[model samples]
Target: MQPHVTTALQAWIASWTAHERAAQDVMEAAFPGLKPTPAPTGCCDVQMRWERDGEGSGTACLDDHGRATIQFEDVPKAAVGHAMTEVFGNGWFNEGPDGFAGAPPGKYCWEDDCTYAECEIDIGDDGLAAVAISYVKIEDVVAILDALETGLEAVRPSA
Candidate 1:
């Protein structure tokens, strides 16, 4: 590659690294037991693995765009609704005759043009819930972590 191209590539990688480090630092502070996990090859996201003794384990990733996704495995089915409500707010789940009808499990933006932050939640059959929250500002990372922590608390049994 040309010298200029190489320099640009290096800068791009550096930006991703910086963002990842910042996000990781925040996570580590919030969850002291969090350990670094290998990110997917060629992916721009930073991944971390965390465990709550006798509770459960989860993985968190921060993408280049500062979007953080936390996936909790083996969560209680009963807690899923409360977790969703905690993160997405009340009325996020639609009511139906049979029971609550969940919103589609995929990405969506708060605004029509998507200029604002994006969010998504996917609940799997095996009781794994992956929640993705995007941030328009770096400081919002704290809020994202708080929301995830709150949801996790709802999922875990009380000490």
Candidate 2:
């Protein structure tokens, strides 16, 4: 690579590193014990893994521009609708057979008038539901996290 290109790349990496550190600090303060790490994909700056003893596991990612996407796996299938309603509110629609336009059966999504965020809930063939909270601000990570936990708890078996 050219000298100037290398310098620019280094600067970008440094900025990204600093951003990740700041994001991790925010996440740690909000959700203790869940450490933030580099996301498996290049699209995101960092990812935090979450798990509840008997509930399920999930990952939350944040990008440099403060966009966040969270996914929860292995949740109760019945919770799919409840979660979608709780997190994204009413007026969800199916994306159709090809999983386009909206979301197909066993899946629900809220995409209209989402200036801040949008969310979806999908139940796989394995009988487990997955929740996706997208376009959320990283600064509101705590709020989204709380919403997700509450949505899952709404249908999870009581202890």
Give the top-scoring candidate (TM-score).
2
The true-versus-predicted C-alpha distance at residue 148 of model 2, in Å, is 2.5
Which pairs of residues collide in candidate 1?
A: none
For each predicted model, how many residue pairs clash, with residues at least 3 apart or on different chains?
Answer: 0, 3
Q: List model 2 lDDT by residue over 121-143, tens digit each.
A: 67667656677777777766666
| C-alpha lDDT of all candidate models, in order | 0.56, 0.63
lDDT of 2 at 159: 72
* Shift in Å, residue 115, candidate 2: 3.6
- What tens digits encode model 1's per-residue C-alpha lDDT throughout 74-145? 444335445445445655334222211243333323421454655554555554545444543445545555
TM per model?
0.54, 0.58
Please estimate how well model 1 matches the true structure, expressed as its whole-model Cα lDDT. Answer: 0.56
Show model 1 residue runs off by greater than 4 Å. 39-45, 64-66, 76-86, 95-142, 150-159
